[model samples]
Target: MSYFHKLIEIGKENAFVYEYMAVMDSENRKYYLERALELSRNTKIRPKDYKRCSYIAFQSFAWREYDIALEYANFAYDAKPTNDIINLLGCIYHHNEDYDKALSLFHEVNANYEGLNPYVLCNISSCYKKKNSNKMAIRYLEKALDVDKNNKLVYYSIGLIHAATGNKKLAIENFEKSLEIDNNYEEARNALNSIKE
Candidate 1:
């Protein structure tokens, strides 16, 4: 088979592994990730050639291996600076508590993409919240809501910002809205319970 054909096979294998990972079976996920790495290595595939580095970084992130996650995320970013990879890199930085880097990447993606993406907006809000910029966080959260009002995560994040700002009523309202959208959202339920009002 040609190199492209081998790459395709590797991609299929990685997809299968990812699907298992989503089901919360860590052992099988690890198995597939390792296998994917092996196949890529045998084919002399560069880390950036086929999103292999990103998948590796995501697995590291899943395992809470922040350092490894950062390394792989960098490789992925270097390979193809797509919005998705940028977002992943931002998330890794956020996990490492490097709020500045996370915020910078999030803004970069948000600025380049003309259409509004609720996830990007919410992630930027999260980075601001981590930096204790409640006002900015709320602003972005509102923007996310404007883009997608039914986004349960945005409502939950808005509730968090309100709670942090001591706006109990608004917090409750947003949390309730989140629960209305996703009845099984434990974070929204917990936030609602935590609020005295």
Candidate 2:
């Protein structure tokens, strides 16, 4: 860590240096990452390095810096609106509580791609859940089930929606399914206990 600090002192203007330092400094990850992003603007930065931009954006999102994530996500999106980038942007918007915008981007990925992606379906379901559209949320979760029946997350999400809607029986069923897939899933176990209580 001290080596990284010394490197930063010598190469204070290097975005990559700060970026790497961020990865090693969990306690100050957000600070170093934001500094790297700020310095990136002044540097050449590889003429639209979508991969790098995406990493910074994802890290920002992980740290709950939605605005910063959105900024870098847009940079990647402008370069090439791939499905992954679109999904990341949707996730950022979702975290920012812009459900409508998040839904639009998630739907765009569904429209442009063939076959169902469980992750995208789950994200769409999450946005719908946020909008209080429990029925729509269940519908997408069902689609996710079709994509991967063994996906414990899908069953867990279904359990959540059912629990919210006061369908205790269905909630128990789905939560059981989730636990059956992964008995160590603490969330499923906790949710199941809560429902039982």
Candidate 3:
């Protein structure tokens, strides 16, 4: 038996062990995830164990179990609420289509966290775009550019916003920039083609 399997059988109450194993045993993710949750409930899990919960939450997010993801994220928040964890919670909210909650949490991260994380800025831009506030979205994306100009996705997002707003020249320019950075960027290429056609 693998060490992870042994841990599952014997240390079934150790959230930390299961969390570690979950990552290690990627091929059997759902199995380990189930064992991890099972183990988590069986012990007096420490506050530090919340990191384990957060790991599980992230895995759940990757698996697209949004509700479980949020639930585990909240569990982690209850243990130790940091900017990173709160940012994760914000992303979960965004995926759930609770834009208001997502934006609020993102703003919370922005205010509380020391430095600007450009991904968070891009998320803010996404929220604004979802609200059809293209100008506001553009503002945030531009801010993201000031922070990290090399993010191809940022350029692609700007291209999309420009396209939506009928700024064809700017849209094409941003699209070309995005494709320049990533030759295999199919979405940017498709967008550029559609615009040209």
Candidate 4:
């Protein structure tokens, strides 16, 4: 790939080329962005490279391009395979709606990499919820709460699941708690409103 090589040669001189890429503009931008990140990686080693790729993956995720997010996340994981990268890959898998794959990645992070962090547990809860294993989902969500009581997101998610399971009182309580923590939480507010009937 001469384009990548050219980028490698140009280095920081052209580093700014990847600042922004509109979603509809070009599919080829993925390669260029990956390469630029790789060029940054070459400075140190796989760790730096993986971080750069992960940053790109996050940007793609924010753009709702799960494919692109997965592509870059895979690169980062292959580069270092750390617990952080594994969990990030798990997040990409989650957003792509491959709950099983997301769960597996999260499990790897939990069992093989980091201890069960609040965020990892929250993601596990999500995967389980997607699979309709409400018991397991609630279990993990509760565990996440134990790990981080201040996480408004955890409360919001638990509210959603509880509402779905017809635990109206518990759902309302969780939604209220979520809103109490972060008053601007639109999803929780909406859920609270819908359930108030």
Candidate 5:
């Protein structure tokens, strides 16, 4: 098949996988994402498409395959150092408990896309929290909240930072706020209960 034809096939597979993902059908999402990866990996196709590699990495992450996700994320980052790919690398590092690496990537991403993405700020906040930098974590979490006041992730992170700083009341307040936005947020619930206990 021609390169254009191969690209078309990859695009179709990505569309199908994304559609399934939108509906939270993890099994179907994985099936179509795997198909997408196979199509993208065909000998006739170029392997330099960072977007496809990023999608594959995301699929691996969704399936909890952290190592594979990290590999693909690194590939995507090397191919194109866009904010999205960089953020994915940061997430992979964070998931693997490589907080220092994750923190560096998050800072790089923040410098490139600062004030433009609450999610990136949230990721930075998480890395700071993991590193036991409670003040810095709170700073970034607040920045995330300023970007998106209704972001439950920011609230949760703020709760964690406050808890780590031994501010149980503030932690409970932020966790409650997180639960208000997402009642099923088990992390917030667990943190709140732990602090209470």
Candidate 6:
């Protein structure tokens, strides 16, 4: 950590140093991330370091720091709008309750990508679910299953929609399928238990 701080002191414009410091310092992570983002933007180091921004965006999203995630994701998208970056930005939008925008971006990925991507399909399903379009949600999840029949999350997601729509039988069956695929899936196990109760 001190090494990183020393590097920063010597080369204050080094966005990578600030990003590294962000990874090393949990307590001051947001501050370090912000500084890295600021410097990276001003220094126009994006061509060489956009992936670092993408990584930070994902980390921020995982930590539920949606604003930080959005900032980094937008920057990364502007620098290089790869499919993964677009999907990450869509996820951020979904979490922020901007379901329409998220859906648009997810569909864009689905249409442009060559092969089937179950995760992207699941994300689309989630946006539909949020919009109270359970039927559409189920449709997308079914597509996900078509791509990967044994995908635990797809089964679990189907179970959730069924459970929400008061179709306990289908919900239980899907949850069971999820557990069959991955018995260690705690979410499926808990959902099954709750359904039974």
Question: Which candidate gets the maximum TM-score versus the true structure?
Answer: 6
Q: Rank by TM-score, descending?
A: 6, 2, 3, 1, 4, 5
For model 6, the superposed segments whose C-alpha errors exceed 4 Å read none
| Model 2 misplaced stretches (Cα beyond 4 Å) | 1-12, 26-31, 42-48
Candidate 1: regions farther than 4 A off: 1-48
**Global lDDT scores for all candidate models:** 0.77, 0.87, 0.82, 0.77, 0.75, 0.89
Model 5: per-residue Cα lDDT at residue 147: 80
Q: What tens-digit string does per-residue lDDT give for candidate 3 at 1-197?
A: 37756866775546566667667767876666666666555666558868778878888898876876787787788888878779889999888888889988988887774336778888888888988899989998898888888888999999999999999999999999999899899999999999999
Report the number of the highest-lDDT candidate.
6
Clashing pairs in 4: none
lDDT of 1 by residue, 21-74 (tens): 433556555554555445544443354453667776777787876765676576
Q: Per-residue lDDT of 1-197 in model 5, one digit per residue for the tens?
A: 24434655576444334434423655565554555445444523234657767776787888786765776676677677788878888998998899999989888988897566888988888888788777887888788888889988888888877887788899999999999999999999998999999
After superposing candidate 4 on the true structure, give the runs of residues whose Cα lies further than 4 Å from its correct spot.
1-48, 112-116
In model 2, pairs of residues that clash are none
Error of 6 at 81 (Å): 1.3
Residues 1-197 of candidate 4 have per-residue lDDT tens digits of 44534654776334334523322335766665654555444543456667667777777787676776777777777778878778878988888789999999898887773444878888899999999999999898888888789888899889999899999999999999999999998998999999998
* Candidate 5 Cα deviation (angstroms), residue 113: 2.0
Question: What does candidate 5 score in Cα RMSD to the true structure?
Answer: 6.6
Please identify which of the two predictions, 4 or 6, would achieve the higher lDDT against the true structure.
Answer: 6
10 residues in a row with least lDDT, candidate 4: 15-24
Q: Work out the TM-score per prediction.
A: 0.75, 0.85, 0.79, 0.74, 0.69, 0.92
Q: 21-121 in candidate 6: lDDT tens per residue?
A: 77788899889888877776676545555788888888888877788889888878877888998999899999889999999999999987743999999
Whose lDDT is higher: candidate 4's or candidate 5's? Answer: 4
Question: How many clashing pairs in candidate 6?
Answer: 0
Number of backbone-clashing residue pairs for each candidate, in the order shown: 0, 0, 0, 0, 0, 0
Q: What is the lDDT of candidate 6?
A: 0.89
